[model samples]
Target: MHLLLVGPPGAGKGTQAKRLAKKYSIPHVATGDIFREAIKNETPLGKKAKEYIDQGKLVPDEVTVGMVEERLSRDDCQKGIILDGFPRSVDQANALSDILQDLELALDAVVNIDVGDEEVINRLSGRRVCSECGASFHVEFNPPQDAGVCDECGGELYQRDDDNPETIKERLVVYSEQTSPLIEYYQERDLLLVIDGETTPEQVFERIEKELDALE
Candidate 1:
């Protein structure tokens, strides 16, 4: 079940990763989560990543690669792991190859959740997060019980600045520019699985499971 998920921000990579990892009994490895855990735990790499993350910039590939290298070396990853928010560039992709080589491991597949810019805008624009409970609400699909209020908690809901249109477009640009090469890299290895993301999350997850089952 070892796999990688590559998608733009707000493309629901986290949602899909959660579903797939649970179904397959694989650890979901997200770089952002790892950075936070490392920083909170005061690890050396976490300290280095914090400096970059605080500035709204990416951690350098060397530091990020080292962190992921250490993560993959853990015993829990021996059976399989699901990667999210990683290998954002060709260099990182190559670095991943080296790391997996060192571990004598091979990725089963790389799943790409492809969504259009307009769809992403509509999806993210409607999203609101609870300031207190941290619950997510989508105005269209899953609105809260009260407008501008969290259902689970009586907290005001707010949109993150990064969910704004301009920031989302900029992130899309970065994702395309950086991740396109990794897509080609995996395509060349015959390990790329492209899935349309406009469908419902369950539909998309079914597609992913089917793809992985085929690989098995």
Candidate 2:
């Protein structure tokens, strides 16, 4: 179940990645989580990444790829791993290929969740988070018990800056520019599996599992 999960913003890749990893008994290696852990621990690489991240710029490939390579070498990754939020560009995809070769492993699939830009904007624009507990809620899908309040912790719930309609539109544009070609790159290798992302999470996972089963 060595896989690379790709999707645009608000496509629910994070949720599906966790479910898929559990079903396959593999670690879900999300780069965003890794970056947060590193930044919290203040590792040398984390410090370098923070400089760019705080400035709203992409972290250098050397730092991002180095972190991924180090994570892949860990014990839990020996069996298999589900990669999320990585290889955001063709260069990183190529770097990943080289890294896997060095580790004597091969990727099984590159699963891409396809969703419309308008749906993405609608999904993200309605998203809110708890100020204290960081719990997520969506206006249309999972609204809180009380408006502007966290259901779990009684904290204030507010939309994140990045979840605004304008920000989401900009993010989708950036994602399309950077990730569209990566789709073709994987398709050329016969490893791309594109699935509809607008459906329920369970339905999306079923589609992904069906494809992965075929691969096996």
Candidate 3:
């Protein structure tokens, strides 16, 4: 199905997006992946995106929309796609609707994984990544065998700068301001599937599956 996954930063949208894409046998069209591929291939739009990214500026909505349109127009996406991390605002959502109209595709659902700010802070702040091999661990949910060390590679584990509680709260504030309206935008169109995300990843995916099954 043509799907969009939306949630706050730590709400497990990426995890569920992968599961849904694999289950449905559709492309998982993530915005970050698109930008990386385009820039690696040195496409015109990719070059434009790189210029802005190199300067630490947000790429313009026009460039982002163009990239999404190009991706959705590809042969592989003719079946359907699971979109992640685009349409962060109502304006972008409108642009996406127009793009899909031109491509003669409609979104089957916009899945909103709902997790509270405190839960998000707890989930993200406790995360640790292996400096050597990039293995992920959580202090509470999945702690390493030894503190501050990787079990797989015996590398030092470090927390990302942005994974601190203060940074996470700030991000949640920004997400609330920007995405609350976008959530309503999809809800008004009757294409929203709100799922509780304050559970284990497996449980969250099960909830999402049930919602998608109801849609079918």
In model 1, the worst 10-residue window by lDDT is 6-15
Residue 22 of model 2, lDDT score = 85
Q: Who is ahead in lDDT, 1 or 3?
A: 3
After superposing candidate 1 on the true structure, give the runs of residues whose Cα lies further than 4 Å from its correct spot. 55-57
Off by over 4 Å in 2: none
lDDT of each: 0.90, 0.92, 0.92
Error of 3 at 108 (Å): 0.6
For candidate 1, give the lDDT: 0.90
Q: Which candidate is the best by TM-score?
A: 2
What global local distance difference test value does model 3 have? 0.92
Per-residue lDDT over 34-117 for candidate 2, one digit per residue giving the tens place of the 0 to 100 score? 899889999888899999999999899999998899889998998899999889999999999999999999999999999999
